[model samples]
Target: MSATENGWQPAPDLPPPSSSVGIIGWIRQNLFSSPLNIFLTVVGLYIIYKAGVPILDWVFWSADFSGEDQSACTSGGACWVFVGQRLSFFIYGFYPESEYWRINVLFVLLAVLIIPQMIPAFPHKKWLGWFFLVGFPIVSYVLLLGGSFSLPHVETEKWGGLMLTLVISFVGIVFALPLGTLLALGRRSDMPVIRAICVGFIELWRGVPLISVLFMASVMLPLFLSEGAHFNKLLRALIGIVMFQSAYMAEVVRGGLQAIPKGQYEAAAALGLGYWRSMGLVILPQALKLVIPGIVNTFIALFKDTTLVLIIGLLDILASVQAAITDPAWSAVAAEGYVFTAVAFWIFCFGMSRYSQGLERRLDTGHKKR
Candidate 1:
């Protein structure tokens, strides 16, 4: 039969590859497909030009870089000179000028510990927990706080800015997670007394405002302790944050534990595994895996919530930015200070969410056909 005869159709003509792909096609589809898109393209270009060109010119071409004072930044751009001059205080606060290397080393160690947990080929899961949760914290505390072992002492009061934010969030997570897990397990347990106590603790914390908790930690906590007992202000705040975060973490983990099927537990029991063994081996591994997204989300929230340290008179990164802006030298740059903080927070939170997505994809093999 002819190509166009006997119900046979001729091959449809194809567009040239260059026209069908790459920049021209992308522009046609995204920027000018409809009247609204065309309008948006024009509006977006105008906005970018208005905002971007001045910013780039001011920050790079017009702004000063090498001066110790805001006097060098005579133009209308970002006074990055202020940042450059005060970079040390921004990072280390009142930390001893000479001992800042301790903080840097501790940060490096944390990065080393965290990097392995992120990789798929790291050591066995149990060993990883032992190293991260048990070993690394001890080492990090000794290196950073430096009260014993002849390392120079840096008081927690001297901690400020981003370093303080990291310390608060890290300590909060480390202390809260195991406590949360135990609460979740107890909430699900058959022991009535334990279940009641766990429920009360979780509910009590969840019911109050975190700010109020911080206030109590700052003001009321000292009254509860012995008269002579001393607690660092930062330590008190960390305790409050952990207690508050643990309640939320408990709920997240509880959801995962409840979503688990009963048969999995029964099967573990049939295998003669005891309570902790069955939960640890057969149940929690699956449950925690299922809830990793939720756990990471809670963690991200806690990281942002560290900004609440401002109410307790601590200079976490957000408060530090506030302090930087209020300085008469940089008062005009409040917007920029906030924008910078938002950008830093966005980068960290966005990276965590992306990592969580990657983990979800990696662990999605259960539903695939063998």
Candidate 2:
């Protein structure tokens, strides 16, 4: 006989106690799980109260948001009026004001091409991928460089500010990954000459400081090039950045490759796959997945390091802010200007980081599941 039928009338399915679930439960579990945790939590809260309140007040409340000039700024809080006035220069730098719509169009086109490619369920992905890889470059080049179809030529020298920064970073990241993958493969090659060459190349680039590379590319190398053989300064900087960053990326990719099980390589061999086919079809996908965080970390570093272009006389976003802050009218806005740049960098880097985490979770391959 069942207990319920025997008059045991199961206690009316009581709800869980309030202390076991909700905000109170979370607080208890995380902050008061032990005496040490409780003490640490109290100390942490005190620190936040002491530091965060003033920072928040300065960053948001007392700051001068909308204004014409420094005259609108008070002694209290930040002088964001300077940032407000020069916002356009921060974004577009010296790009022609009338041609702003071209850049906007490029951005729209990029989102159209890239968003679809990023989504797995999207149709025509193969077409979109080809278009992004092949067609978009041509379109973007023609649009930005603009000597065709009645669009006036905008010289590369005029490119500066955040626009310049993004261009350099985008080019570096796009070119670096594939070049690095090749270098990593070469490093692990069976031939002594190829392995030695890749190792030497990676070590040579990694040993030098980035500033030195930029200096040689921008200032010194021009003197050595044949007379009348002109090269764009931005292009030179790009080459050096690609070469340097690829070394780091190669190391990251190699780490991922090394992490793959030996059985994977043997399995591919047993399937009668050639070396290149095995790597492309079986090994590389798993290897790249394992090192998503490292790759993203390198990307973030490259983004920030774009600021170093200031040394080569290229005015990246940080340089633009520095130039604006140096103006006599906005002389006191150095702190606010730097803060704005910091926030801008943070947004892009944080976005990459969060995206990497999501990608890792999505491509987890059952390794992290029970």
Candidate 3:
């Protein structure tokens, strides 16, 4: 049927250009938009292929998983048997085998308390969060240290591996954030004495390396305590981590506080809000939102830095891995131990990073233009 001959010619429709739709279009626009980009993309893919393939091969394709010991790993692949055999030690350190149930109980309790707070549909999240932050530590202390209710007292020296790592990081994070916020506020106070005290504390702590601070806490801190006071190694390290990290956290928070516009303060004051109310109800929420990335970054660094506790005789997860590799039977499997340690750390840190990103997206508002 020839439309032209019918005197009612129909206009033809054509498909959109293949270069402007679908995955191919995305690749064209994002990866090959220019000649330089095309070159870089090609190079990047080549690099990934060269590095990733062998890593995957070593990790899974040729790796030993089901073996009970290193002898079972003879395929020239990663000897994951070493990690498997010592997995409990890596998790709970020298804590008594019979008490493994205690650690599991703590893990279950943590998830029960935390998951509800994360779910948006859950009610009274605020109260739960407060309880988790304040009460859970006490509960954990009783369970882990086991001094109360006739439970055998597990000394501080008995704690190590991932349990110790999590303890230090969690307590440091819980205490540091609030303390740091207060320090930031004090630093910005109108009273010169209060401001000077905060400035001194922040500068003093920030000036020293965390390594030195840890060393001091381990060796020298005991001299100043009252006579007969029993200060445990883990306790000292916890105190050091909090104070040291608080200094850095204060700065991160202060940067956020400064970014806030002056008009917000005036608005808070106009509503008859006092200083604490103004800061807590209005200023802090905005300031904290703006610096979510920095706060999370500090936390990530602190989590990794817990590895340094090995210096003061604390066998954190990395230290536990190091200990595992020292065994004569598993000496050749050091790489596997390290890879396991790395994967464990990466999982936790990546979770925190992603969660912080989601929080930032949820809180970030009003500043973007339409």
Best candidate (score: TM-score): 3
Ranking by TM-score: 3, 1, 2
- Per-residue error at 308 for model 2, in Å? 1.1
Error of 3 at 227 (Å): 3.9
Q: Please say which candidate is ahead in lDDT: 1 or 3.
A: 3
Ten contiguous residues minimizing lDDT sum, candidate 1: 361-370
Clash count in backbone of candidate 3: 0
Error of 2 at 313 (Å): 1.3
Q: What lDDT does the true structure give each of the candidates?
A: 0.84, 0.87, 0.89
TM-score of 1: 0.87
Q: Ranking under lDDT, best-scoring first?
A: 3, 2, 1
lDDT string for model 1 (1-370, tens) is: 6776788887889777775479988888888999999999999999999998887887678766767776776777677767666667777877888888888887787777777768888878568666877787787788778878888888778888778888888888888888899999999999999999999999999999999999999999999999899898888898899999999999998988887888898999999999999989998888888888888889999999999989889988888888887888665766667767787899889988988888878877573233
Task: Provide backbone clash counts, one per model.
Answer: 0, 0, 0
Per-model TM values vs. the true structure: 0.87, 0.86, 0.89
Model 2 over residues 1-370: C-alpha lDDT tens digits?
A: 8987878866778777889799998988999999999999999999999999999899889988877877789858898888888988998889999998888897788789868745778999878967775687778789888999999999988877777887888788778989999999999899999999999999999999999999988887788889998778888899889999999999999988988888999999999999999999999988987887789889999998999989888889999998988898776788999999999999888987877787677777864324
